[model samples]
Target: METKHIIITGTSRGIGFELALQFANAGHKVLAISRKTPQALLGHSNISCLSIDLSIEEDLEKVTQFIEHTWKKVDVLIHNAGVLLLKPFDQISAKEFEDIYKVNVFAVANLTRCCIPYLQKGSHVVTVSSMGGIQGSMKFAGLAAYSSSKGAVITLSELLAEEYKEKGVAFNVLALGAVQTEMLQEAFPGYQAPISAKEMADYIFNFALTGNKYYNGKVLQVSSTTP
Candidate 1:
């Protein structure tokens, strides 16, 4: 496999961390960004961890500049960072909604905008969305803020695909179902997780490397029962 410079957000732990590990193990240079550096990634030769809170607008520019200076270009950009605030609709504070949007929507847009100039042909832009972003099942009550933000991300990816298709940059969204991650634990405490983070990571990494044009602008849903 040819080595590529991959940029992944929300890599402190969970799906993002696992994605970074899988890509780095496959000989790619992975730049993992998160609010704090994970100790497990301290000495990885193929991985470089950047501490940046994507919710902060100022940090987005810094991250983009850092990537441009260090890697010059990004072959694969994964927007995997997100937030979930489970609270009653009436109890959800304005601050909580703003926080979720900052990380899940605004930050994604900012990062993608910054990377556009540096993205070249054959580069892939993948956003990690959610099933809630799709059909909006009523299984969960306190997920209004989180689900709406993810829905916006899915829309953004589709729009980006259309805008960048002529330039050969592929854009897609991964609408993942329940997976065993820190976020999952927070959402469903005391319940056994149905899927593993490693499993999801492997699937996503393989899909991105397939170089298939069929997946461009597609919202691929992954669940335990689907595969």
Candidate 2:
């Protein structure tokens, strides 16, 4: 297998952490970004840990500049950092909404824009979205803000895919369903899920490596049924 250089956001925990380890184990060079470096990933030859707060535009600019200086191009750019605010619409403050969009939509867009110059043909960009992005759940009483932001990410991925298709760059969204992670536990305190972050990470990494052209611009939903 060819060794690819991949950049992944939210690597301090959950799916992002697993993805980083899996990619590095597969002989890929991974640049993992998060607010702070996790001790577990402190020193890995194939992994470069970057401290970046995606909510800050200046920080993202610095990251982009660093990537441009250090690497020729990124083979895969995975926007996996996100925030979840579960509160009633009325209870959702302006600052909360801003925070959600900052990390979920704006950061992803800014990073994608910055990476365009460095991204080569055949490169893939994947956004980690949620099942809420696809179908609304009335059962989950207060998830409007989070759901809306993810929905926007899904659309953004589709539009980006079309815009970059001619250049051989692919944009896709993974609408993950009930993955067992810290985020899941926080979202649904008592709920149990069949999917684990490791399982999801394995699928995502394989998909990134072997997915066909037809998979571009699609929202691939990975649920309990998914393997």
Going through the candidates in the order shown, the clash numbers are 0, 0
**Window of ten residues with lowest summed lDDT in model 2:** 132-141
Q: How does each model score on TM-score? A: 0.95, 0.94
Q: Could you give candidate 2's per-residue lDDT for residues 1-227 as a string of tens digits?
A: 78898999999999999999999988999999999899877788889888988988888787677777877788999999998988899999999998999999999999899899888888999999987878543235588888889999999999998998899999988888788889879977987789888888999898887663568999987775433
Model 1 bad stretches (over 4 Å):
136-139, 225-227
Candidate 1 local lDDT, residue 41? 76
Cα-based lDDT for every prediction = 0.86, 0.87
C-alpha positional error of residue 12 in candidate 2 after TM-score superposition, expressed in Å = 0.6
In model 2, how large is the Cα lDDT of residue 4?
Answer: 94
- Stretches > 4 Å off in candidate 2: 135-139, 225-227
Tens-place lDDT digits, model 1, residues 1-227: 68999999989888899999889888999989999888887688999888988987888777677777888888899999989988999999899999999999999999999889888999999899988888644346899899999999999998999999899999999888888899878887976667888888888897787744567888988765422
| Residue pair clashes in candidate 2 | none
